[model samples]
Target: MDFSLTNEQELFQQMIRDFAENEVKPLAAEVDDLERFPIETVEKMAKIGIMGIPIPKQYGGAGGNNLMYAMAVEELSVVCATTGVIVSAHTSLCAAPILENGTEAQKQKYLPKLASGEWVGAFGLTEPNAGTDAAGQQTIAVEDGDNYIINGSKIFITNAEFAHVYVIFAMTDKSKGTRGISAFIIEKDTPGFSIGKKEKKMGIRGSATCELIFENVVIPKENLLGKLHKGFGIAMKTLDGGRIGIAAQALGIAQGAISETVKYVKERKQFGRPISGFQNTQFQLADMNTKTEASRMLVRKAANKKDKKLPYSVDAAMAKLYAAETAMEVTNKAVQLHGGYGYTREYPVERMMRDAKITEIYEGTSEVQRMVISANMLK
Candidate 1:
């Protein structure tokens, strides 16, 4: 199997890396400090087609494959996790479902604007009560003549406040449990749709997560995505793609931490020599590099599977689980390697360590990933 990136993919990766370093990285600290969304940078990303990496060209996307998308995400995430997630949620969670399952009219109505970043997109699967237990969603959508009245609240919704479109899951038949769920594409200006409080998150502060409340919101019947009572499968399939992006994000964070730690160790002197001369520091760096590379390989393997249209659910889960945990571990070590300086906001590693924690929590937790992998093995 070929391990090398095609020239086009390599060029795409370099372009993103250059953009991140020159544009996103310099502003990252300010964005994190103010907890403000970088709309200008996001627009730039969209204009450059990074926002729609995996989407089809006919839909105004980059016409790229999953591996290329992962590479772009990793490059952005290396500088700013917030930017990374914004693009990921839009491309992976929001647009992907509509592209994969929506009817022609649905795709025509949503994909172009979302893919071009004319409007942001969000996914609403996690309700206040249903996170990992998404099948237990209490949000309800009742069918009416030519429309559906949705009434429920979704919490921790990424990009909810700024998004112009949302793909939401609601229970249409409680008796069917998971099968009872249905998906809808709701525009932001729909009647009775409103934004709730924005969450003050611990990290990825620039990515706006908020509560989305639908109070008897009415949407056209044509807005339904996929067949009735099939949203659970759609949600899970979207997440399968999302997991790969999350793993790429984790890989980026780990790479950033390792790069920074190496610089610090070489420059900071201790005991009449550079810290790099110390055996402990050397060993720490070695371990971090090794683990990060391993995580990267896992992510690439999963992305390859996705590109080939092979079964990748287990690979995606493993990559996300291991890479996210590795990010946490590597960032922790990076902070330690920085000694007292690491704890201070003066260092990027501190922020990186904070950013790394969420990867393990979202896109299926580490525990959930293990279950997915194990279950797939038994099949």
Candidate 2:
């Protein structure tokens, strides 16, 4: 079993790393400090084709694969996790669903614009009462002549503020429970559809997260995505891919924290020598690196399975669970190694620690990932 990045993957990684260092790292602190979305950087990435790395060239994407997409997310996350999630939610959560499930007409109509970054996309599945219990969705859609009238709201929708397209879910038949759910492709400009106030989050603040309100919003029947009453399956499959993206993000966060700590320990003197001279610091760094490397292996394995079109639900679950836990643990240790300085905004590690937390919560919480893995094992 040879484990190596192909030459193309290596080149793509270098390109993204350089872009992150030159374009993203400079603004990361300010983006966090002011809770500002780096829209300009996003535009720059679109122009560079980072926006649609995995989509086919016919659809105006860069024609890369899932592995490349995961690598892009990892590299972006190393410098700025908010930016990482922007791409992840856009590509994995939104665009991927359409690519995988949409009809040819739907694909031709939407994928080109989405792939070109002419339109940013978002997914709306979670709601006030529906979170982990997705079957509890209260959003309703009633069929009308040539259209559907949707009424309800979704909370915690990433990319909600500026997304031009949304892949939304609602109940068409509440009696059917999860089977009642259906997905739709709704445009942002549809009448009575509006974005609510943005959430002030604990971390990844620069990522646009807000509520989606659909007050009798009307969309044509053509907007119905996939088979009716199969939205839950679509959502689950989409999240399988999304979990891989989050795993990569977690791995990158761990790597970034390690990089910062290593530089600090090598420079800071203690007891007449650099802290790097201390065995405790050495041991801690060793553990952090080991855990992070393990996370990388898991992330890559899941991504490879996806690229090969294999069943990867279990693979993604394990990757996300381990990587998210590793991120939190490593970032905490990174703070400790920085001493009092780590507690302050002067050091990026503090922000990194904050960013590491969301990886455990979204895409599927660590608890949820465990459930997925265990359920598969028991089955």
Task: Name the lDDT value of residue 364 in candidate 1.
Answer: 90
Query: What are the Cα lDDT values of the candidates?
Result: 0.91, 0.93
Best by lDDT: 2
Clash count per candidate: 0, 0
- Candidate 2: where is the Cα deviation over 4 Å? none
Q: Candidate 1, residues 12-38: lDDT per residue as tens digits?
A: 878988999998999888888899888
Could you give candidate 2's per-residue lDDT for residues 74-160 as a string of tens digits? 999998999999999999988999999999999899988888887898999999999989999999999999999999999999889
Candidate 1 residue 255 C-alpha distance from true site, Å = 0.4
TM-scores, all candidates, are 0.99, 0.99
In model 1, which regions exceed 4 Å deviation? none
Candidate 2, residue 57: Cα displacement in angstroms equals 0.9
Cα shift from native, residue 84, model 2 (Å): 0.3
